[model samples]
Target: MSQLKYKRILLKLSGEALAGEGGYGIDPERVHELAQKIKRVRHLDVQVAVVIGAGNIWRGQIGMRHGMDRATADYMGMLATVINALALQDALEQIGCDTRVQTAIEMKAVAEPYIRRRAIRHLEKGRIVILAAGTGNPYFTTDTAAALRAMEIDAEVLIKATKVDAVYDLDPKVNPNARRYEHLTYLDALNMRVGVMDSTALSLCMDNDLPIVVVDLWGESSIERVVLGDDIGTLISS
Candidate 1:
């Protein structure tokens, strides 16, 4: 029998992951590699729901800083996420993983509209569901969406997959002396303004008692390690 710590999980991947080392737009080869990593976890019978960001394409805050309307910039960011979601969906399906793409903004021509019950059903039937377009509204980050969806779907935990391996007291890259938090309470993260996730998202996870595991997706078998109960990165809870 497969021993799994969290049978159901919500993974938050930044659009930058798809951008790869080049740092902009979708890179097909990198997307395919990510799909393979996801496939490894799916075969473990883990029910996975992913929320991807739009930083690689466009960032609402960046647009707003340059004088774009706040709502308009955010909406554009949401659309960018949909593009990443579709690309990811294509990659996963190409690898023979049964998948479904659900968008919050309701693009029926491309994907099913996000329906809570229907999404849960897809997981129950062994399909990996990729959630796109953020919260279907402006002014929300994909991090918030991940927390919200994880709670709505009763995900055992939320995995914040990032370029960095763990939550550190300081930037590990910039400061060689920075120390990593082997574990933390969500309250600790928020109190210290730790950027494990955006403040709003962290608060949501804390209030609901949903644990989050911060791991580097670039690490070999990192996703699988998290699902199989191996300690590979920072763990935050409460």
Candidate 2:
């Protein structure tokens, strides 16, 4: 009902967001809750696309530290994202929300390969498109994939769903007096190295002048507020 500030949005979700209390693996309840939230967003007549991380199931860095080959670990992490993606797709479809899971790495038996035009077309037809796999490459984070996919889909804004409500100069948990920024330029974020997002992903968004809103993923009405231009989170742009 409110005037939408961003008609098309790419939602970047960390896999841990679906991990529930255990903090590992996909929690069905959490996935269902997320599906409901996304369904609500779609009800607003906004085209929604999602890019999900695989931290819940696997972390390439952790694997590499444990002596796994870098590329192998990264590929495993990417496959983990597909597992998350399929779980989400099932939840959405069960609730009457149409969704398509597109993977950067081809898996024709399970999902469609990532195709830019086809993805955009799905969005136009009112289906939520979920992008899984981390760019089909090693040495890249899902954040980068989200940024790249956002640009490819011509999304008006990239909504980064995080555990925290906004970007703070320091960890709010560690320092009570840490400053919270309502807005920040891409350069400022890069300089600060806030760790909210990686440099490579940030650079891609910066190069394309893509606006990013970092908001609390579980906060009540958080995503909806941002979509309606409520200015409830740390907005990074320009």
**Best by the lDDT measure:** 2
- In candidate 2, position 219 carries an lDDT of 96
Model 1: ten consecutive residues of lowest lDDT: 187-196
lDDT of 2 by residue, 161-221 (tens): 9999999999999999999999999999999997889999999999999999999999998
The Cα local distance difference test for each model comes to: 0.93, 0.94
Q: Model 2 scores what on Cα lDDT?
A: 0.94
Per-prediction backbone clash count: 0, 0
Misplaced by over 4 Å in model 1 are: none
Instruction: Tell me the spans in candidate 2 whose CA falls farther than 4 Å from its real position.
Output: none
Write model 1 residue lDDT over 12-118, tens digit each, in one string.
Answer: 99999999676888999999999999999999999999999999999888888899999999899999999999999999999999999999998899999999999
